[model samples]
Target: MEKNKEVSANNKVDVDSRRDFLTKTPIPELIIKLSIPTIISMLVTALYNMADTYFVGKISTQATASVGLVFSVMAIIQALGFFCGHGSGNFIARMLGAGKVKEANEMASTGFCMAMIFGIVIAVVGNIFINPLASAIGATKTSMADTKAYMSIILIGAPFMMCQFVINNQLRFQGRAVYAMVGLMCGAVFNVGLDPLLILVFDMGVRGAAIATITGQFMSFLVLLFISLRGQTIKVNIKNVRLNGFYLKEITNGGAPSLFRQGLAAAATLLLNKYAGKYGNDAAIAGMSITTRVMMMLGSAVIGFGQGYQPVCSYNYGAKLKDRVREGYFFCVKYGTIFLVFAGAICFIFAPDIIWAFRKDEEVVAVGKVALRFQACVLPCMATTVITNMMLQSMGKGIKASITSSARSGIFFIPLILILPRVFGIRGVEVTQTIADILAMGIAIPFAVSELRKMKKME
Candidate 1:
């Protein structure tokens, strides 16, 4: 028993040593290994979203759409979460690259603390303004009750959601993507398991779905905290958690692009729901919700790849290996484009089936099918924006990254959603997102190409 225990301890030390070496490994290999876990983690995330739609859809179209209606609020919370997570993660990655372990630890601790505080604020504010907020996001009278119930639970759990993000991103920066994946996947699995039990068996409806989701998020948080304590090299010392103005500024600056992107996504969803509501009933809102969720799932793999590439780009840039950074960028774009093309093809081919997965209402299916097909057709191009913005942010080009991040949902899509729907009606609604995606890609090409050329010039 003593000898067996000795071997176990030694093996554990070896694994830790290997993980520690990962941060300093060859950038390409590190990214590939890191990204595979992230990809799986993201897929698990997508699965829960699908589960949400599926379970909610089983209740009623209104119930499913209510999930969609309140999606904007979720987006807002995610925006804040990403702002803190990405901001601190970027700083952590660079600091690790530069061997500033102490600084990295401080950023991690402070970022987690800040996210918790902000999440509490959002939870309070969200609950206080639940009715008005739901209305603002295009919840009709029919959908309003369901939306309120769902949003309330989500808001109540905002701190856990936000803190989970903080822990996940920080772990990734420490080159522990697998650990991060474990936490995410565990929560997702639990959520998926609970959805049916809560919604169907317990007959809890929309509130049940929300409860299940919150429970999953809390589990994820617990797992993430355990991983941080047990496996991570950097320790978050609460005593050392004083906010360094400069570090805070750096984190926020680095993470601002994510905030812009996610924040604008919330705005776009709200506007889309509102516009759709003006035309028809809750069905329209529901249809748009299902369509977007489908697109998001299909897009997850690409997003995962981009996320995988981010740490590589940041680490290489910090190490001043400009060539490696450029190489990783191009590799990610190529891989992302290919993956999106395949995903888009699948979405386009099965648009109806995909919509039906959420709800079987003929009208919702018809509307969602058209929207899904159109969005899928533009998927490849749309992926460019994700890669370009991620690369820019990873390299610490905050301004350019923010612009790229905002272009898709904020700069172009929001206005087009408003104008095109006015001119063309529901048809405009179907086409608006596609047009926005194409234009965003068009704009992204020049930026990505120009940036790459600049890297060559440096060479």
Candidate 2:
């Protein structure tokens, strides 16, 4: 009896030490420690994307616009990747929290397998219908060649991109975010270094950018695969990767919100490019591209922080610690809002300089400046909406999450994009996104409030 008591005391001490490590650490300090690495990873990614735009912009306005045209295709691929990654990561985190290590390992393997299969299918289909795909994404006669060249390489590299996402998300959920960051950072560096060499030295133009991006993705995949196999807490084994229909359903249901959100974003970009093409000049498309790249850079930082909060929220929720979930949510909103506000202000203040960094065309710069300012003004609202939606999704509130996800681009932005441009012309293009951001935030408020009240009740 005495020995049993002693063992119990020792276990208690160890558990208390762990709990102290998690809670006594300052919340903001922990968030920054987790998020800064993610931010660095995201910044590296954005830098390479910008490098692509910069190099491609130097080729011609048409070439520059072609990058925008292919963005929707990339978005679709990302939609799938995010769906698999986030869905599995959410489940894995919850499983770990519940002390179901085996289940988490199974989920990791299943998600990786699914991503690879889907990516390969997309690559085959996209390659076969390259022309149709390009046209559907708003490729103009002048932009078609560059679009095709860029997109073909991306399609072929789809499996690598998708697998990398699976590895990244799983690592993050395992509380190994630094490993995930390393993989992404390395890939971004590779892309950035290779862009100029391939595009300028090899005279490959837009295709060169695509090749560089694919190579980087492949390298990242290799690194992530190694980490997943040897270093991660979650073990992925092919033999254990069986199709449990119920688990599959759970993953898909949980992931559908991300799919809808990202898929609609891709569609919206396609429509924007198409509508801009109707203006009979590549300048409009190029301007939109520049504005989007800048906005995404800011958005990526916000998203990265939100992502940092996701695992914490999921783990606490699964553990039935409703208060911690609430705390994490509010913390995310506060940090995300402040960061976005400052970022928006900076973007607005340097709109012209930002646009001109990508291209020197007077027309592109003029159009991009207005768009950038409008987007900047809407950034804080967008950040709020993103955090709210992420909170709901990470908590496994699928239906509500899907509605929030669809609200911005699908329910509001799409119809507005189609209607406002008809009534207000090019100016409508700038205003539509700003209005959508505001409306999305407005919708998020009630949902967030209700969720908070529910958390309080649970407490």
Question: What TM-score do all the candidates reach, one by one?
Answer: 0.94, 0.94
In candidate 1, position 82 carries an lDDT of 87
In model 2, the clashing pairs are: none
> Candidate 2, which ten residues in sequence have the lowest lDDT sum?
14-23
Give per-residue CA lDDT, model 1, range 1-459, as digits (tens): 999888657645643454355445776677788789888877877776678888999999889889988778888887888898899999988887776666777888888888999999999998999888887877777888998999999999999988898888888766678888999998998899999999999999999899989898899999998887674356566765757788789878988999999999999988888887787567777888899888888777888888888877777778777787787777788878888899889989988898887788988988889999999889998668998999889888899899999988999998898899889888888888898888888778888888888888887
Q: Number of clashes in every candidate structure?
A: 0, 0
Q: How many steric clashes does model 1 contain?
A: 0
**Residue ranges of candidate 1 with Cα displaced over 4 Å:** 1-28
lDDT of 2 by residue, 206-318 (tens): 99999988888888889989888884246668976857896787678667888889899888888877777775368988998889888888888888888777777777777
Write down the lDDT of every candidate, Cα atoms only. Answer: 0.84, 0.83
- Deviation of model 1 at 135, angstroms: 1.1
